[model samples]
Target: PVHAARLTYEAMRVGAPARRLAKSLQPLAGRCDARLVYAYADHASALAADSGPRLLQVADEMEQIGALRYATEAAAYAADAFAREGRQDSARQAAARCRALNARGHGAVLPAMSELDNNAVMLTPRESQLVQLASQGLSNADIAERLVLSVRTVESHLYRAMQKLGVSDHHKL
Candidate 1:
């Protein structure tokens, strides 16, 4: 089942049509591992098709079955899809799920998830403050002085924060 799941994901990544991939996954569907993978594949397909509700539903099922990583990723996808569809409430709900999963140490630090308006970059409080100051146009040295930290420390904080935010530039903060 795991092998089948890996093949399914690999096939999808290589641009196979969803119907073809679904047919391939069909035989493995009755197995537990394969079912989890199928749920993930379905969630991905729903997201690609802009089916926000279906995406969320599949994500919820994944989470219920303890597929934490996939569930978290699905929720993030659902959030983005919902936002694009102008379903603000649903988007917020999905974003909240992503945040919750991350907080519980289930989700990866995903840049795409950070793009959601309601989803703040996952940062330490100090990092958050540093990013806020940087966003206000404070120079690193000036921010260091304002925060009473050494310039090197400020730069380190900024670098780590940017890394966590999946951004290459402070301006993106």
Candidate 2:
């Protein structure tokens, strides 16, 4: 059942609608493994959020057939929903649960590093300078002043640098 749910989720990821699947599973919601049902319901809800409104129905079914893992994942999902809705307090509460679950499962807060290609460079000299200053926690304006360039020019260089490094944000650099 878990395998089936995972396959179904993958199908949904590849553009298959989950509403019909969710409806079909309604009869087995209680009889099926609760953990599998929870995962299925999560995928259904995510798909519905983007594809349609049937996810709410799936969520209702999930509530009727609950499990501990589902509750944990639901907290994380709720945090994301609240964050999207601009409800900071509710989001934080939910995010805290996610962090707790992550800690319990992995026993560490940081991602493991890979040693492969650890020392490589693809940035130009000016781009390297932008990233270096950014790593030191300098603001764009400060970096610009230090480099004797206009703030907008610094921003352009940083943008290009991040692009070349395949990162989207300064924090990633």
Candidate 3:
């Protein structure tokens, strides 16, 4: 019941929530109760509506974790898939699940899911902050204002972050 409610809420947005849920939870198919199975289906439907390709990847992961019934295995599969695909939408969804499963409630399913690879040159704290904001799609002017730095400074930070990450633009980050 609790899981159903949670799945419903998650499916409330972007439609086809159930599809994503289904694919993501496929590995737990027989292990989960009817309520959870329904919730998983609903979530997969939701994912399908928002991003079909991503849901496909989620389904792939679910298949990999086969009958494990462990959140860590689920998250590990997600993180690994996200790393391989570099899909922001899927990574975000997987990250959310990892965080949720790590919470005090929710059975504390996954304690140490593998961390996503961060294979880039290091950034200073300020540069890291700027990169974070940039990844969120904030404009240079907006980021500068928020950080109380000049636009030129913000641009410089962005430039440095991109260089360190071995990328030519912000989108790669």
Candidate 4:
């Protein structure tokens, strides 16, 4: 169920019109972080101009439910929604909420909040490992062998990681 929610949330996050998948989780709305998914789906429509406010409402509600992590993520999503609408003022407020949530918690930046932090680079787990390995002088083939992945896959992950790091060469990984 958690996996399903993640897949649905990711789909919605990437601008996929996967509301049907999100709707399927409506029954679980009051449990296991489903409320956030459902709320995202509700605001995922094209004309949902109130996404920031609505999502922030959900974030506050999640706080009352003791789902601080989800609340922070929802607030981050709210920040993005506001940014997309050119609402810089609202976006900054949402960003502040996200930071507060992070400080109140373990201070670990959640995936959703990474975009709100300019100092953070959003890297996939695989890309992070590839960068770490490449930094240690592991060739693509060596990384492939160590991780049981294809050489092409290793190269691809390294290429993307370097791009995210704004390095022109894998040697900088």
User: Which prediction has the highest TM-score against the true structure?
Assistant: 1
Residue lDDT tens for model 3, 1-173 = 44654454345332434454556455554455654454345435434454434443444444444423333334444544554555655554554454444442344333324242231133578877888899899999999898788999999988976765445777655
Instruction: Locate the minimum summed-lDDT window of 10 residues in model 2.
Output: 111-120
19-92, model 2: which lDDT tens digit per residue?
76665444444557665656575556554563212332333344455433433444445555555565555455
- Candidates' C-alpha lDDT: 0.70, 0.54, 0.52, 0.67
lDDT of 3 at 92: 49
TM, every model: 0.57, 0.39, 0.33, 0.50
Error of 3 at 121 (Å): 1.1
Could you give the candidate ranking by lDDT, starting with the highest?
Answer: 1, 4, 2, 3
- Model 2: how large is the Cα RMSD against the reference? 10.9
lDDT of 1 by residue, 1-173 (tens): 76876778656545566556766665566565556767746754675576767767877787788876666767777777777777766776777777677666544676546565334334577888898899899999999999899999999999987765556787866
Model 4, 1-173: lDDT tens per residue?
Answer: 55666666666556565455445555444456555555544434311444788778877866766768767877787888777777766776777787677667667867777666332345578887788888899889999999999999888887876655556777854
Measured by lDDT, the strongest candidate is 1
TM-score for candidate 4, residues paired by index = 0.50
TM for candidate 1 is 0.57
